[model samples]
Target: MPLPSKRYVKVNVSQQFNYHTEAFNHLVKMLYPKRNTINKYDYLIDKHAFFTESQKQVISKTASSLCMLSEFYRDQDKFGNLYVTREDICNAIHILQRELDLQNRSLLLPPVLKWYAMQIQYHFGSDPFTLKQLRLQLGKSKSRVYDAVRELEHQKIVKLVGQRGHAHVFELVEHI
Candidate 1:
């Protein structure tokens, strides 16, 4: 009789899994390609002069906590695809705010203002931005975004640089 043929098992190969920490590390590397020697947070704080030292520390801690919480509660679907919804992010922010309140500390800036500052710093950086651009990015009413921008300008965090067509152009103040 011929020897029984061996059956070979086929293994399914999938794309490599991406963890939140790895994604964060990759982002840091991309943001600071040539400054590997310096701490990323410190470099970012130094680069953005609008935030006070206390605000910087608070923002950093809050961001780290949010990332941790988001990762902990990350969802996976039937296909093993990892994802986070807008609701998840909002919940995380609410939890973080409650925790801070319980600890007798509050976010240094108003929620809207803080969010606006972060959006500007991360997206627009030193580049000039218009109210229309901000409104489109934030999905807020033109008046609401204008008010927030006015508040930021009052705080000396941003300056009215010029006008672009019918919209007013603003740029983050390099120094307070």
Candidate 2:
């Protein structure tokens, strides 16, 4: 049998205004794959029912800011695959929250403390952890980790729980 001529048709798959919701949802999924995280975002959005349109727009802008921050903090492996840890998401959220906090003009935590907070949230959840463990995990000097821990304590983000030998045990006041 004679072969038929081959043909190709190009379909545009670019995002459009009509696909805004889908795109937003996809971005949310990418940033927060966990059901609990998605629920948190949904709850925040649901609370905007009484907010003015401008305020709602600010929330959308914060979401975009989070996406950008997440990309900035993403790590890459030797194989070129990207990795976004819970720490990265937490850091992004903290940055966005600081930017959006009009009433509380307090400075955001230093990068080291932000990193520590995320690590605590990721590794220990609400449980207590020792400074020694954090130092080992971060591969930082003892003094450096101690200073960061002190800063966290000063900010009321973490509370000193107890002491084990020379190491100080602390627990997160709330998940960052």
Candidate 3:
């Protein structure tokens, strides 16, 4: 007998219904082969049959959200190269969530100080900015800006630079 042709059969997996079950069914059929029968689609689906219900759910959700046949599927770019991988997107999301958590945790400061911190990050980032310019740009009063900047300095998120007359220059500190 000749070798079996490896081909995947198109199965309609809907987002509204049991897409998780359908995907697992396909994966199961691929994992265990009949003794005398040739299973062609085995190569298409993932051979890992040791996944738990939760892991399977994660894969199914990822695949459906990404609009792919399975989580093991590799999407190609316009240049015919391997583009966005499932693991890549997951890693990016994890990183973004960590960043968000960091930002949220740093919100222990007052509301005005928090706003000032975000504004500083947006406007100057790591660069030095003058208090006069910040007050003018943010359209806030001089005393309010002064108080917020003082609170930020107290939190060690920013540090004062060289004093230019009554106006002070400051820059964001490291690791913030």
Q: Clashes per prediction?
A: 0, 0, 0
Q: Which candidate would rank higher by TM-score, 1 or 2?
A: 2
Every model's TM-score: 0.38, 0.39, 0.38
- Model 1: how large is the Cα RMSD against the reference? 20.1
Cα TM-score of candidate 2: 0.39
Per-residue lDDT tens digits for candidate 3, residues 1-176, read 99998698676533423455455546644553321112222222244444344544444333333333332455555543333344533433332222222333343455666778889888889988888888888999988888888877866688998777877889988433
| Local accuracy of candidate 2 as per-residue lDDT tens digits, 1-176 | 98987697554433232245345546766665542211134345446344445434545544544544455455545654345454433444453442233332123566667788888778788888898887887788999888888888866678999998887899988566
Each candidate's lDDT (Cα)? 0.58, 0.59, 0.55
Q: Who wins the TM-score comparison?
A: 2
Candidate 3 segments whose C-alpha is farther than 4 A from its true place: 1-105, 174-176
In model 3, residue pairs whose N, Cα or C atoms come closer than 3 Å (at least 3 residues apart or on different chains), thus clashing, are: none
Is 2 or 3 the stronger prediction by TM-score?
A: 2
